[model samples]
Target: MPVVESTTRRTGGSTPHRAPGRATRPRRRQTSGLPWLLSLPALLLLAGILGYPLVRMVELSFQNMRLRELISGRPAPWVGLDNYTKVLSDTDFWAVVWRTVAFTVVAVIFTVVVGLGIALLMRRVARGVRLFMIVAMMFVWAMPQLVAAQAFRWITDSDFGVVNYVIDKLPGVDYQNHSWFVNPWQGWSVITTLVVWAGIPFIAITLNAGLTQVPKELVEAATVDGASPWQTLRSITLPILKPLLIIVTTLSVIWDFGLFTQNWVLRDGHPEPQYQTLATYSYTQAFGQSRYSLGSAISVITVLLMLGVMAFYIRQMFKIGEVD
Candidate 1:
């Protein structure tokens, strides 16, 4: 005798017969949609703020948008790649590009090294180190850039600066009086000092968090295997820290590229500055001379640069993931 299939009754119709060949999986109930739903609001917010503005910026970059256009209420003429070509040919733009790259590289290296050392020191100390580090870092980082720049300017000023005064008092160290901002080298010195001061805290904070995640067991095991501290750090800590290092380095690159306030205040707004940066150059074009299109062009270039750096970072992450 053949087995009869079971039938179940429904609210609005006659019983439907069930095919009882085998038990089926519960439709693999998707949880991916749940996470997407949870994240949708944040994604929308990010698109609204960053994505929309960037789209508008790209659009405006291609157009000859200006005060005249705005005042006359005329549609901006699409210039295609004209602005970009002009910026590329400009000598001032190149100078700014060089200075910006140098500044970012130097500042990032200084910040990362100093921060890593500080984090290590903070980790070693058991008594009130946290409070001291937090207070010290916060003091420098919390100050307004303008205020810090002004204070530093006064401190490093040739005429009345305490630094020069102290130098003057010192025995036989080239006591030639000079304004620190008078030369390109001096300008970079001031800029680098400010960059290091502003950057070290972030590095220390990030590296310290990374250091915390490094397992004590791993360290002890390495020690038991006759690995020195430096060796252990090289072999294990650094490898484990790849992700955090990538994040820190990428952010540092982006931040340092757009360095403006410190450099500006260091030299106090010279239009034809000897040590111009792409950002400062763009600012001068837009605000100093009201050349909106040129400024927008510079900004578009910067966005491209940032995108390149971001792409490099993503590639590195993918490589690391594959290695893991």
Candidate 2:
């Protein structure tokens, strides 16, 4: 007992022993500074890529910079708001804006509606069929914008096109050698069709992912309560998926607004001036006519217009969310 008591006295009782050279660790103080420091590189990269061009565009918009001034050693003269005033006063520009809006609205509506339908159908399909559909959709979505436009052009060509041949086959219908691009409206229709076809795959895939997250138990409860399919969808499915739908629709609106490649390719050499969108118009002013400042102004205005549209959609989404 004396030996045990002597040993206990020499050693610390129930306390952790530290190494000879060890010291107590200090507590970490939480601050937002670390996160900001970590994000600094990403911020700089984004500024270099996006911010630089935007600043340059704004600066160019205010200056009288044409191809001639760029070619010569002369400095670009300040034009102030002349470019903006000219664009705003042009009736043709306003016409293009309205046409672009119409096309975008129609295309978004068609894309969302068709996509929702496809997503819903996918839920009921066999696993093998679903895989095949998904693969096919990916292929369509992967198709290059220019390639799709060119394919559509070939399909709708005035001479020896499949579309004309199909129309001619219908009784009392003669569409042989019919030119789809003969008028502005017809040309715009083809463009809209191409946009809708190309856009549907993405929306469908996104919605399908959203649909998978929906509660099957809730759906079963609705079915057990004798609710019709449409009733269940409107009262349950859509409400649950509102956030996703809003996001998809907003993206569609933005994409359709700045739709350039397909439209340009489809109407390569012969887009009617009245039917031209902001993108085509800006391209004409910039590359086609060498009026750099005017083009920059138009491009700036286009961005402002799109921002306004996005703001409206965001406001509406918030309102709906609050109501729910």
Candidate 3:
């Protein structure tokens, strides 16, 4: 019998054949540079708007930019690290730093805890009650910081203030014409209360939104498994909400660490040393004391501190992304 050659042709004489599905599988397209190109204009605009001032501030921090130089339209003489040295050496500055750190810690803690509680409450409340709470919170959030600070100031006024009036009405309390700011602790308490009250709306609303994303089936499973409410929250809810908590807490720390409007306005635009935070301290140094360079240094330091917080936030976000 004659052997006939096979009619089929081999594409690759030695290569193994690939399965149809594997052969047809599409590769993921590389991410395009169009997105970066499209965003260039906004990035440039922000650089001009925000970056210039920041650079100038740093420049000023290295100089002796007194009122005289500001008025003379002449460049301030460079002073190298003298401004930083002066600021770092001042005992009062250290006191202000400690005070600012303490206030931030207290304010952030209260804000996050209270905000979380309100968020949980919102989840459990009747629809109408929840709506009312949301509306009230919206109003508070919409109100300007200046207005809120003024309102709090009026509320805690030494004379003709409602807080004193209500306290004095108690059976044996003598809070009439009480001065809240006379004591630093009391003043800080008031400031903290204002900060927490103002902050809760944002945190509560955001967390409540996150709560909606929680799987109802998982929650039900936990309940069916005889998990107490606290246990469920501790085990399930908190772990899920960890990302949101970190975000809000970091933002609260940044805002409260730079406590300015509330402290300045409450103290009538002249916060005493006892009540001074980094922001107020910077302003007091620059405008209040005409130490522009020193104030710039303080501001630069404050920015550095905020950057540290932001870095931690970014790191936490990366961690969450990795976990997901």
**Most TM-score-accurate candidate:** 3
**Candidate 2 TM-score over all chains jointly:** 0.85
lDDT of 2 by residue, 142-230 (tens): 99999999999889888968989998999999898898877777878888899999999999999999999899999999999999999
Model 3, 192: alpha-carbon shift in Å? 0.6
Candidate 3 local lDDT, 1-324, one digit each (tens): 122222223332343468776656588889999999999999999999999999999999999998998999998999999999998899998999999999889889988998999999999999999999999999999999999999999999999889999999999899988999999999999999999999999999999998987888988999999999999999989998989899999989888887889989999987888999888889989998899999999999889878989899899888879887
Q: What are the runs in model 2 whose C-alpha is more than 4 Å off?
A: 1-29, 309-324
Clashing pairs in 3: none
Give all candidates' CA lDDT scores: 0.82, 0.89, 0.91
lDDT of 3: 0.91
lDDT of 3 at 301: 82
Stretch of 10 with least lDDT, candidate 2? 8-17
lDDT of 1: 0.82
Q: Model 1, 150-253: lDDT tens per residue?
A: 88888887777888888877788654466776677876887898888888888887888889989999999999999998999899888888788887888889
Arrange candidates, best TM-score first.
Answer: 3, 2, 1
